[model samples]
Target: MTPHELYADLTRSGLNLIGQALSIFDADLRLAVANRQYQAMFDLPAELTHPGTRFEDTIRFLVMRGEYGPQDDPEAAVAFRVEQARTFQPHYFERERANGCCIAVEGAPLAQGGWITVYTDITDIKRQESLLRARSEELSGQVLDHAERLAAANRELAATNAALQEAQRILTRTEARTRQVTEMVPAHIAHVDGEYRYTFSNRRLPSIFPGAAGNVIGMTVEQALGAPTFDAIRPWLECALSGEAQVFEITHPTSGRRIRIALTPDSASHGVYILSTDVSAEVQAREALSHASKRSLAAQLTSGMAHDFGNLLTIILGLQGRLAALDLPGHAAQDVQATLAAARRGATLLDRLARISGPREMALQPVDLARLLRDVATLARPSLAEGTVLDLAIDLPDGQVLLDAGALQDSLLNLILNANAAIAGPGVIALEARFSGEWIELTVTDTGPGFTPEALARAAEPFFTTKKGQGSGLGLSMVYDQTKLVGGTMRLDNTPRGGRVRLRLPLRPIARQMILLVEDDDSVRMQVRGQLTDLGHAVLEAGSLAEACAMTDLPGLTMMLSDIQLGDGLGVDLDASLPMVLMTSLPPGDPLRARAQGPVLTKPFTQARLAAALAEAGKRT
Candidate 1:
């Protein structure tokens, strides 16, 4: 037999063994189940005792047999009982039937719209009362009255028992369901007493805090969460106990996860409720946005000043150049050369500042990391001091990753120069690249004195440099900014020999594909066409949207790169289904420029910018 069938059979057998007669009816006023005792007690026929029998029919049969006492009209009595059963309530009473048997009947409602009635025989008790009244003439009327009241009390007790059973059943189900819900939740839900002892938990503490034990109930806070974590949140727990609700975040030392916790005081319960959720991703995003916002504000503040500074430097360099061109004395010539060199350095610093404070966005495109790293190594060699030895350790899979090759090269070169400068003389710099989980980790380690504690902390900040007047300090800041703009991260720390700077970039791999190029201007179109060709893409050119639309149906068409302002019409109006990147020279605030659909690329963009736009378009499509 099936498990359900066996369980039903067992339940029925067990019910039949009970001394009390029991029957259950469905909401439809149809008999659902009855124990054998129920049938025997009522003397019901096979038809009336069987499942699916109408409850009204059983009542009618019983009424006819005077089960509920004699009635003048039995049909009317059956109708009344059926209607009362339809609106069933908790009821208990005793009645002497025509067969001269006294029984107590108790009924309780079910959750899914039904009722169960239990019948307990009380005939012997009733007979004892009659005997007591007839034989005990010496007994007072008060004693006889008390004896009669005993049956009612017994009925009340049976009703109370049934109510308690129903209540207990509901409570058990509710608790089970509540725990199930809390267990399924992503956050940890727990309760702790004022003494900092865990009273209850959903066994999710270990999941949220990697080192915590799952069964932490009855354990002290210290035993559950180790000293480091407990110390961090103990103050908040104290605040919660003082009838305050607080929310905070902490970094898990073991797992390095950012956890957001909320604690609320339970005044009546004399404990605190805790909720904790892993919010590492959220915290990272928030930090990135905050950094970006600060950069934007700094950019706005410095743009005008940098402009004037550039103008002043240019004038000085020009005047100094004019003076140096003419024949002069040795000391005068040396002075002019020094002034020109200082102006050039100032100009370089200004350029670095603009880079850090500018509205720079990464142009993520499919880039061959091996080739990029090799080129950066070669480009950085010229900048390193003569005694400095630069070494490259490139270890990466053979694939083009979605990245901004130009920005990446700049950041790496900046690090190489910084490392070269850190080592006063005759030191080696090593660069390594490899994939670490979801991130492409690029590390630059230099054999130098390493960063001072203050430099290590404030290195990413703008204009915080150890090179004094020789360094702009904006180099690392620019690298940090670019890393964050692409949703990546940069870390600076000291190694035993020297400092190590690592950039963690998400590994987004993309394959190079054919691109359909659309632009009206012959020179601009051809220039971009060459750029795309250099990026390992075969480009098909069209001067107008009409031509581009026709070429879109060309077999093997992968994507479209077009100017927002086309010769025939706007490129955004093209009926092409391919992923598109629109190029525009219009000002940023122009409504017409902003209306181009898909990822927009501003005109006067580099090859790297175009590729990044394509990568973004590829992502959306």
Candidate 2:
């Protein structure tokens, strides 16, 4: 027999072992389960005792047999009983059957519809009562009668108590199930009363907002969420309490995460329901998309104008070159040279403008930040005045983080050059790098005259330079653009010591290790090997899964990057100790692709995308 059938048989046998009769019916009024005692007590036929027998049919049979002591109309009596069963409620009663046997009936409604009924025979107790009334000379007639009535009442109360206990059990299970569902959700689900005190919570506050109290059942909103977060949403809370629903977003001051909160008014009480979710990733993605759209529009508007302007600059340069080649008078030659210089400066300005409005993508890769910063200082020192000193202070955990090294290098160089110009002589230029939670912060400070109010407000705006005719003013603007494209932030401020420019970028650290590359195609394998080499990782190539598996025991092997479909076997069947990333050309819905145990990359991908996939694999490991 199947396990399910065996379990059912065991359950039936146990139910039949009970002395009392028990039966269950479904919402459709069909018999679901009945103990052997139930069938024997009613003398029911085989068909009537089976599952799916209608309760109405059973009632009609019993009524026709005079089980209720000869009802005037059997059909009418059956109809009445069936209707009462349809609206069944918890009940207890005692009745004497036509056979003169007494039984106590207890029925309780089920949570998922239908009801359970238990019948206990009380014939022996009834006989004891009759004997006491007929033969006991020590007891008065009135006292004996009162005693019999009290015994029947006590039995009814006992049956009622059993039904009440069953109802409590069902309620407890329901409450536990509801709590489980709410806790499993990825957000905070809570309710607050009119006093702004929390009444119920799923204990998920800490998961959504780091450092939040796990349980806030009796705490006020301000106390639970902190003063700053509470103040930010206080107006919305008031509106919700006044029967108006609200949905809004805010940045948590402590964790720097974006939170989306929805408050719904409870119509039946002076309270509000709350749902809070962490939407930091969503907000970052949306901002990145918005910046990309703006860049596309700028490129379209400037591409044509830039083309025409470039042609004009070329003509001017060519004519000026021809003039300089001629044997002209000395004074006239000097004037010509001056004119050429101005025209050349205009060409340079056009180049900077093109860079500002051009389409570019962040090529993120693992970079040694300390090494990058040292290189920046080495390059900037030669440009600084003789008295100027470049100082570097880096306080960060030991690791390489994902960054666009070239872009960051250019931005830092520009800031250092700008700071050098700001200082007259003998000033300290300090570069500091540190960690702030999931972000890497870099700050450049100079001991020069701090920025004026206007410069502080517009330093990052295009063509808003402090240098009158010497600066192109696109340096800070380009730096700001690059930072925003990668969901980073740039801030300009004036400190007591000097002017400061701070940049904060997401810190995604990835470890460099030897990797196994598995692919059936030689050309693809070679191409991927070159990409890995460029990212500073040693790669070992294999033509199939069997070859890859043979090298799994190699020393210093840290991870694997493999194609899903291999000649001998699938890459997912590899050992799970080493982190893995899979690449495939299979359609998204393909079963093999869906079976990928780690991060999956599409077949045609760039070095940046591969770096990202490897980083994700590292996180999973």
Candidate 3:
């Protein structure tokens, strides 16, 4: 063909063969020729299209990098395309559209001039390529990991094979030795399948059960024992199959012999090994020990219950005395009062029994030892004989001691009554408390006959009492328990005047603050006011919040003491200047209780406690 004709033919063929868009540039990177596909692919603006348009200018107009940005490396892309054209190798470039479809450009140099580039819509191919690449990367990582693991497994297998060979040699010798030893031992030695089928048994099996060893191997528990012993061993056999190792003592009724059996399952070997030991002597000893423990526990429970009952009786009798004094003219009043009193007394007795037999689980709270002592003395005063006078002289530091209030009260009441009973003349039962270093020391002094050496030594032993006919002797034991529960120590010593039980409870230094006492009950208010006043504080009394709020003039009030439900109603206005402490008998978690701002001291608290809580609040403030 002629040169001009060849050029024309080549241009036509190149434009057609390029597939979509064809573009060529000179070494200087100027636009030479662009096919119809090229114009359409770029959405070439008619305004910038002319014969001599610069390639770089065209790219700036045609290309947007990702979503809405200019191409970052346009110059470098041009340079790379130029290099590919000069090198005579086909060059490929991927371009993406706004719709996420990708166009692949396969650019090649035209033999006549410039470059020929084909545009292929390769969005699907690109997506498949991405998935394939991700899968390949994952598979490659897995293959590398698998190869390393396989290598490690080979090494482990080799080592295991060596160990197995050595173990096999040792096992052969052990089996021979085991068979010899088995025949010599008095007890039968045997192996069974996971299904409990007998795999092996020693000669002793025949002696234990005549002809039992014969045909026992490869036979089930039922087959070997003929359904009798199998019934006894069935549960254990099932447990073994479930992969549990069982060791138990069974009594053979027919043999009348106690035997200890151990069965261990081996799933890999599909068998369970059985070991039987004669334990008739051990069984008898254990039975005897169990019986003795039960007797001891029963005695302990009885004494504890009796002592608790005594405390409850004292409370009931006190209430009953007060009830009897009241004028009740009608039959209904008398009968109802009598019935109620009887029921209360019965409940008290039952409570005592429950406390003695039940576990001594106490919910511990921070308590003042001095306050607890005084309250106990006052409660027991009503129960004391006419001549007995209870004196509580407590001088403890304002410190918190962990304790259970009910149990402590019971212990104190028991001691006080015991003191009243002991004294023939005018009796003085003094509950004295004081802080000594890290402990609060409590001494119960009685003007009675002092404890003997034996009595002092056995004071805390349950059921060991001097008042044999009258006492259960668990009073001091309960006291001992209380002392231990609070991580404290107790001592029974002869006082200069009479008998004294000294208890020292561990002290935990807590924040001290002033307290506000709010109560409408006159006796309760007086008792609490006196208690707080004696604790050395500026005691502010408020029967209601109006009275509580009236204390705004008291410049140094640290806490506002208020009742949860006052004589009028609940106190809604909280004096923010002072922390509020509620003194109420209402159960905790009551909605009214939530309205209070400070810690609550349940009603019927002693003066020392009111003082200590106020002091704690004062310190925190």
Candidate 4:
């Protein structure tokens, strides 16, 4: 037999041997289970004793038979009993039957919406009590009455005790379930006493603060959170304890995760309930969006001015070039050449402004850091003087990191030039690369006079320079701007030997793979194909997304470049197996282009720009 059947059989046998009649009724007042003694004691028929028999039917039979003594109305007596059962109160009572017998009845409600009743015959005990009262002359009438009342009170106490035990069992189960739910939640939930000690914890301290101890039930707030984080939230904790709830975000020390914590006061107990959740990704996305917004405003302000400035510079450059080519005096020709040079420089400045201030997105791609460091060193060596020594240290691991290669290269070249200028052609310049935390650290150190305090403070500001005649004052600023644009950081300091500038960008792995080029226009397709080939990628051609989908199974085609408004079909519907970079001549404000994630290359992009765009598009998957 099943275990449940065995248990039921055992329960029935145990109840039968107890010498007391027992019955259980469900929430609907229908009999659920009954012992053999129960049917025997009540002299009930099979129909009334069986499970699912209505309690009212049983009561009506006994009432009509005068089992509860002669009643003015049988219906009234049965109705009263049925209504009392509906309330399901735990009770104990004794009743004298018509057959000169007495029985004790006790009933208690079940936790799961039911009631159980027990009946015990007490006819012999009642008879002995009556006989004792009659035979003993010393027993007063008042003492006899108190003795009977005491017995009734004892039975009531027994019934109350049974009810109390059941309630306790239910409460224990509820508390266990509640604790399990709290422990499973991703966020931390805790309570701190007035003395700042943890009174309750869900054991999620390690998740909120990566290096924190998990078993911190009784630890002081400072001890659990460590000194740095504790101090940061101490004032807020105090405010919460003062009955004002508080919520704030903080960055974890070791993991660099952003945690948003809410502190609610337990007004009655004078403690604080804490809820904390990680919000690192949210904060990063928000900062990136804010940076993009600022760039948009900058672009708006500069586009018109830069456009007019460009026309003027073009006119001056054209006039100077024509004059220089004509037959003229030596001094006049020299003047013409000088004017042309200045006009060209102005045009260069305008282009730089557009890059630094305009909405130029970071074209990120997987770049091999070790190789990038070597290339930087090679490009920088020609700028160094004969007396100066250049040192290149490649300490990076064998992996690729995502970054805007062109922008980063330009920043490093600026650093090299700045370092060369600082050392005055006769000192050592160290170019170092390595990994630190989640960033790839690149440090350029030169043997030269360090920056003055004023220069250091304003070095990253636009148009701030100490070199009066030669410098445009935008190099360091441009480097700082580029770093921020890519969600990276830049710092400048002085070592004992020289000035040091360090850039730390996010580390992302890059893998070289073949790219499929999809364009309907032959010229545009050819041009893009050549650009991909220039970037050392094996390229495949496709005129439509249908062709692209057919090529999805090609082993080497790991990435795709497609035009959104294609001749055969929309590029967005192409098989998503390959990471995609979409090309469009649409304006930046166009919803279709603006909503595009990852990388997008506009019309008329250079080979270097196409390389960067492809790298970014490769990350979409």
Candidate 5:
């Protein structure tokens, strides 16, 4: 037999072995399960004893057989019993059958609906009580009667107690299952009373906000979420308590994550329900889309103007060239040459404007920081005046970071050239690059007269240059545009040393390691294996945590890429010494996913995303 069939047979055999008769009906009042004793006790036919038999049919059969001592209206009696069974509650009772046999019945409701009933034959016990009452001469008649009644009452109480215990078991299991489901959700689900004290929580606060208390129950909102976060949402909490629902977003001060909170008034009580989720990724995507839309609009508006202006510049350049070629006076020739230079500069400015307004995609690739910095220094050194010193310093982890190399190079070169121009004579220009948390910070500082108050304020604005007629005014603006395109930020500041331009970009390093790929699904394992191979990494595959653990002794194993939920064990329980990157299909708020020690990649990720995850894992090592 199959395992399921064997299990069912075993269960039936065990139930049949019980001394008491047992029957269970589902919420629909249809028979779900019954023991052999139950059928034998009622002398039920095959049809009434089988699963899915209606409760009304069983009650009608018993009533027609005079089981309830000859009811005047059998149909009405069956209807009454069936209706009682439909609205079943925990109960206990005893009744004498037509055969003069006494049986005690106990029934308890199930948490998921329906009820289980147990029947115990009490004929012998009843007879013993009657015999003691009638034959005992030492005890008075009234005393004997009272003792018999007390015995019967005690038996009834015992049955009721059994039903109550069964109900408690069901309730406990139901409560446990409810908690498990709530804890699996990726956000914080909580309820707070009118006084702003937390009454319930799913223990997901820590996952939604870094360093938040895991259990907020019995704590005030300000105490659990800290003063700053509570103050930020205090007004909304007040509104919710006053029966007004609220939904809003806030930036978390500690983690810098965007949090979306929804507060709803609890109609059943004087409280408010709260749901908090981390929406940083969503906010980032929305901002990127908004920026793209604005750039597209700018391109559309500037295309015609740029074309017309290009034609005018061309005409001016052609006429000026012809005038310079003629036998004109020296002063007139110089003026013609000047006109040609002005037309060419205008053409250059138009090209820069087109670049700024046009659509452009970032070309991200792994770039060696040390080498890139050296190249930038080399390019900028030639443009420096005599005796000017260009200093370069780089302090970063030992890995190639993913970035748009051309864009970064152009930005840095422009900053260096601007610094060079700012210094009147021999001076020092310092370019420094370092790792700052999850960003690469590059600063270009020059020992020159600091920017004027007005220049510092509008330096990054397009066509807002301080270089009179010698500059096009688009250098810093182009740098700012490129920085934003890559989700980076640029700041223009004046330090005690000189003028400083600092750029901060998200750091994504490229990690190529001897990886152990552990996944339970064969197809998924193969697909991920292919991705890893395409990224130029040698991969070893395992179908489960056990298999993966067995291969830990393999040589040259630099890191492990594993699924969070494996067959034998969790990926988080794998070798702690080895660098690991976990993959999962679980929601971000799930406790298992949130508690993972290493970086996690959600399912259906591309090869590029895998590479980035591997890099993050490599850094942890």
Candidate 6:
């Protein structure tokens, strides 16, 4: 038999037995043939369908739903199916119905001219394929999701690493700052191990010893320092090893100098931190001060005794004056008057001696620095050598200070006289005063050859002098001692042009004498008020010149004591006869100096002198 005849017979027999559906069609839309399986499945009565039936119509009849396309484009699916079959040579397709009918359609080319299309009712197989496709899509989505999660985890890890690096950088910067602070510290610092090995030391440690330049780490203290100092430090080292800290002083052998040393325990290595400081200069200064203090005490004792003796002489002189007034025998009375005169001269000598010693009992009172400055200028004029002239430029505040009047006046005279003697030719002697907080400061500047270094060093030392024949060497020393007694400080130095002495003494904040004190600096006004109260004077307080001026019209206001640099303006309009004293913290050359009508006083005057000046003013008024 022929191959085509055999295939046709086998196809027919297989379709009948397996209830399979089969179809054959040309490229044109026509029903070529249908197998028995196809007829049995759709319940067709005829083996062959009507001629000229479109392929799309047959496909729509087989498929209840429009799975392919609209009825208007029925030929569109036919063209697509043909093209698919041609491209793949053969293809398998399945269609499913909503009511559970599943069909697999397979098209393959026949050896004859046309092709055969077979439709098999594989409902279960097609259903399984669809379920498997959905599961595969779900698995693919899970893979994509997992990939995104992994990418996000990678980004988080990178950010964490970056943050860690940033933290490490901050820690490094903090450590660097800490190291710089440690190195720049002024004190000596060092660390040593149990075996006396030097662990660490700051930059200043080497400067203190001058011997440690090379690396000091790992060298025992004894090996590095060689002997006694190392032995002396052994106990301190042992204390640190025993977990205890120690602080002590010892003399170093190399420099043979006393040093203060401290040891602290280091927990990391059980070592010790050694800190040593040089106190040699401080020790010497303390000893010198102690000696000078002793001398001053002795001088004070002598002065006290001499002062008592002077009081007794005063009584004797007073009695003699009365005795001389009495009319008596001429010879006897003359002899008694001579004895009294001699006793009075002796009393004057005692007073001079007491001045030489540092006088103990002093009547400290608020003194007008301006008046004292004027008096010193007057006293120094007569002492100026042949061609020399003394000049005084003063800005004295009516402000009073608490001080020993006689001693301060004497000190001022000495300074002025010294200045006059220093200059060989005519020279200007400038005296200036100003308020400094609670103290009044006076500067006496002289245009003359400056003091030599030797003289400057020994200026306040007793019995030390540059003047060969004329100086007793006790003038400045007495000044210094007196200043100390009054709780003041005096500095002698060479100015740009000549020699100068600056004296600072605490002043009473307020003056109670029939005057009003006005100042912008509240502390200064308060201090001046306190000084006035101390001197038994009543001081009216105002914060500014305007306030004081306003009080001028007010009842019971006596005198205006206002600062030149007042809140409103300079106190230049103060009543001239009302005893207006311009108070200032500025020096003499200050413009306010010329504007003030009454006497000006710098800040920081002693109590007694201020009261005397005020008393004199009151008497004049």
List the candidates' TM-scores in order.
Answer: 0.56, 0.82, 0.30, 0.59, 0.67, 0.35
List, residue by residue over 1-621, the lDDT tens digit for candidate 2.
Answer: 999999999999999999999999999999999999999998999899899999999999999888987788888999999999999788888889999899889898888889999999999998998888889988999999899888878877887887778889988998999999999999999999998899999999988877788889999988888998888989999999899999999878667688999999997889999999999889867755665565566567668798888899899889989999999999989988998998999899888888888767779888889999999999999999889999999998777888999999999999999999999799999999998877888999999998999987777666778898889878887888888766687777888999999888877787787999999999999999999998889999899888999998899999999999888889988877899999999878889888888889988998888988898788887
Candidate 1 residues 394-479, lDDT tens each?
88989888788888998999899899988978999999999875568899999999989998778877767888787766788888
Sorted by TM-score (best first), the order is 2, 5, 4, 1, 6, 3
RMSD of candidate 3 to true structure, Å: 27.1
Off by over 4 Å in 3: 1-296, 299-350, 512-621
Question: Where does candidate 6 have its weakest 10-residue lDDT segment?
Answer: 62-71
- Report residue 63 deviation for candidate 5 (angstroms): 1.2
Instruction: Tell me the RMSD of model 1 versus the true structure.
Output: 11.7
Prediction 6 global C-alpha lDDT: 0.68
Cα RMSD of all models vs. native, in order, equals: 11.7, 4.8, 27.1, 9.6, 9.7, 31.9
State in Å the error of residue 36, model 3. Answer: 97
Top candidate (TM-score): 2
> Where does candidate 6 stray beyond 4 Å?
1-291, 294-362, 436-438, 511-534, 538-621
How would you encode candidate 3's per-residue C-alpha lDDT over 79-117 as one tens digit per residue? Answer: 554454556444554567776778765655443445545
- What is the alpha-carbon lDDT for the whole of candidate 2? 0.89
- Indicate which candidate wins on lDDT: 2
What tens-digit string does per-residue lDDT give for candidate 5 at 1-621?
A: 999999999999999999999999999999999999999998899888899999888998899999998788888899999888888777888899999999998888887689999999999998998898778988999898798788878977887787778778878888899899999999999999998999999999988888788778899988888999999999999999888999999877555568999999997889999999999779767755665565566577779698799889989998998898899999998899988988898898888879978767676667888899999898889889998899988887787877888999999999999998998789999999998766788999999998889988778766678888888777987887788877786777798978999888888867667999999999999999998887678999999888999988799999999999998889988887898899999988999997778889999887667777787788887
Which of 1 and 2 is ahead in lDDT? Answer: 2
Model 1: residues >4 Å from true position, as ranges?
1-276, 289-297, 512-621
Which regions of candidate 2 deviate over 4 angstroms?
A: 69-74, 135-146, 191-199, 213-245, 264-272, 319-359, 374-393, 412-432, 443-481, 484-503, 520-527, 587-589
> What's the true lDDT of residue 35 in model 3?
74
Which is the winner by TM-score between candidate 2 and candidate 6? 2
Please estimate how well model 5 matches the true structure, expressed as its whole-model Cα lDDT.
Answer: 0.86
Q: In model 5, what lDDT does residue 275 have?
A: 96
